[model samples]
Target: MSPQPHEKRQTLAHRLLEVRLQGRAAVLKGHHNTNYVLRIGLPLAVVLGVMPFVRFKYRVPLKTVEVVPRIWRSEVDVLAVVCRHLREVPRGFAVQGDRSLHRYRRGIVLSEQNPHGPVDENMLREFAAFFVRTAKVPVKELPAPPRDWPVDGESAKFLHWLIEFTERRVHLPNRERFGDLFDQVGIPADAMAAFKERHLSLVSRRFVLLHTDVHRANVVVRRKGITVIDWELAIYGDPLHDLATHIVRMGYSPTERRQMVDLWERAMQAADLGPLTAGLHDDLDTYVDFEYAQSVYPDVMRAALGLPTEAGDEHFRVAAERVWSAMDRARGPLELKSVKDVDQIMEALRKWHSMDAVSAETTVV
Candidate 1:
C-alpha cells in the first residue's frame, strides 16, 4: 500500500535531504516548495521539486485525485510547446524518475549574475515576442488536455471552473478547521462572493496556453534569453490570468508591477494579438483574488507545520503577519465575508498554537 499521510510527508522531506546530501546542489526555496539546483552540471541540471504535501485533515480526497494527474499531464503538455515553439524559454528534458508523478525540469539555474527580479527591458520584450509566437502555434500543434480535464477555456467558463476548483480545495477538505479559521478571523461565512460570475464580460478573448505560476523563482535568467522553469501549475486559460498570477506572485514593487503591466500591454498589442487584452483592466483583479483564495489553504497549513514550539512567539508573529497579509490582499477582491480584521486574525493564530499543531502530510510539490 502507499505510505500513510505523515509517512508521505517524511518521505518527501527525505527526498529533499537525499538531493542535498548529493553535495553538488544548492537549495533554493520557492514560494510553495523547496527545490534543489545544480546549475553547473552538464547535460542536465536537475531540480527535484519535492515539498511538504498539504496538511488536509484527510487523505487527498478521491474528488481531488483527478487534479494530481491532470496537472501533471498539463505540465507535460505545456512543456512540449515551450520546447518546440519558444526558444526564449528552457527545454524540459524528460526524466526517468518523473514517470512516477511529480518531477522537475533540469537546466542552467540562473544565479545572482542572471536573476528573475529587477525587471530587464530586453527580457520583457523578448517575453512579449514569446507570447506572440506561442499564440501563433496552431491548436493541433499543441498537446491536448487530458480526458477528464475541464475543456472550457473561454474567460467566463474558465473563471468559473478555476474559482470552483479553489473553493473545493480550500473549504471542503478541512471544513471545520478552515471554518474555524474564518470564524476566528471574523470573515463572513460566505467568503466566496467575489468568485461568483457577474458583471465580468470576456468577449473578444480566447484562451491560450499560460505559464500560470510565473514568479521570480520559476523564471531564470539565461545568456541567450529568459528561461522559465516549474511547469506543474501551467494551465490553459485567459492569457490575462497568466499575467495576473505573475504580477501578484512575483514580489515586484508597486512601481515595478506597473512597469510590467505597461510592458505587457504594449507587447501584446505590438504582437497583433491585442484583442486578448480585452477586459484585462477590469477583470485582472478577479484573477488576483482567485490566486490569493487558492493560496490561503496551503499557506496557512504550511505555516502551522513550523510553529517553533520551543523557539518562541517571534516565529508565530512572523507567520501571522504573512497570513494576515495574504488575507488583506485577497479579502477585498475576494469579497471575503466575515473576516475578522487583522487584529482578530493575529489573535486566532495565537489561540491556534495552544491546540495541536497542523500535521505535515502528503502535499503538492
Candidate 2:
C-alpha cells in the first residue's frame, strides 16, 4: 500500500535528519540554488537543491541515472541526474566525455543562479566546448521543445515588456543598482535606444534550447567534478544567448573575455560547425549586451531582499559607473580636463572615482 501523507512527511523528515546527522561539517551554501553536502560515512554526496525559480528537491540513489527530467518544470532535476551520470563513468573515458558533461550541467545551473561569483576557468572552457557540441547535434535526433510554448515573436515581446518594466523603475536603488551611473557616463540616448532596438530584433531569431540564465553561483565544484543546479529558465531561443550569459556572468577581464570567445570559436571548429560566422557573432554580441544590461538586476534584487540601503545604493552607483565607462570606451577618445570642467557638466559621482578623476583632468574639446 502507498504511504499516507503523514507517513510520507515523517519519512522525509527522518531521511533529512539522518543525512544531516550523519553528514560531517556539511554546510548549505548558495543564494539561489540551495545545496546540502552529505557525508555518507566515507563517500561524500553533494545533494544539490536545484531550481532557483521554483521549489523542488531530489535525492538520487546512484550516480548514473537519466539526466533529462520526467517533468518539464524540473531543470534542476535534469542537471542533478546529469551530474550523477557523469560521476559514475570510469576514470579514463570519464575524464573526457564525463568532464564535458559535468561542466555542461554545472554551467547551465550556474547560469540560472547568481552570475557574479567565483568560477573555475578550465571547467568553464570545457563546458563551452560541450555546449557547442550538443547544440550541433542533429536537430532531428534531439528532444522536442516544451509543449504549448510561444513562438519567438511572443517570447521576444514578453522579454521586451520585462525590460521596459524594469527600466521604468530604474530610479530605485538596490545593492547593485547602476542605472544612475549609466546616465552620468554619457551613454548617449541614441546608444540606449539602439541597444533596446537590437535586443528586440535579435529575440525574433530562430529559437534553440537555451539556459536563459548562466551565472557563477548555481555551479558547484567538488573533488569529483562540477555540478550545475538550476534550470527553470530553459527555453527555446538563440543558443548564443546562453553563451553570452555565461561570458558576462563569469566576469573575466576584457582580455580573458576575448579569450573565452576564442575558446568558443575553437569549440565550434572542433564540432565541425563552420567558422564563427558573422551572423552567429552578431547573435552572441546582442546577447552579451543584453546580459550586461541585466546584470544590474542582481543589485536591485539584493536591495529588495533587505540588504542595507547604503550598500545597495553603492552597488547601484558603481554598476552605473561601469556601464557609463564602457559606453565612453565604445565612443571616441576621452577629452576632459580640470575638476571645474568635469564638475560643470557631469556631477561629481563619487562612486566613479577613476572616471571622475579622469574627466576632471581632461579638457573637453
For each candidate in turn, the TM-score is 0.72, 0.51
Q: After superposition, which runs of candidate 1 have C-alpha atoms over 4 Å from their true positions? A: 1-24, 29-74, 93-120, 146-153, 197-201, 336-343, 358-365
Which regions of candidate 2 deviate over 4 angstroms?
A: 1-25, 40-72, 80-125, 133-196, 203-208, 212-233, 275-278, 304-306, 309-365
lDDT of 1 at 314: 75
**What does the lDDT come to for candidate 2?**
0.44
Give the alpha-carbon lDDT of every model: 0.57, 0.44
Q: Alpha-carbon error at 42 in model 2, in Å? A: 12
lDDT of 2 by residue, 1-365 (tens): 99776445445444543554563533444443233333232211222222222211322222321211222344433344333334421111111111101122222344444355454568657667556644553443334555644454354553454355345433233213344444444433333345567566543444445555455665655455554444544555456666776776667667667777777777766766643333666666655665555443443233222323244445445544544444333442122221122332124244444443445568463
Tens-place lDDT per residue, model 1, 1-365, is 97666445445544544453476544555443344443322112223232332110100112221221134443545666766776555433333333212233344444454554576667666556656666665556557665545454567667766666656665566655455764565444555544564424454477777767666566656566666766666666678778877777666677776777777878888878788878777777667666776666656655654566653667767777777776676666666654455555566776776554433222222
Steric clash count of candidate 1: 14
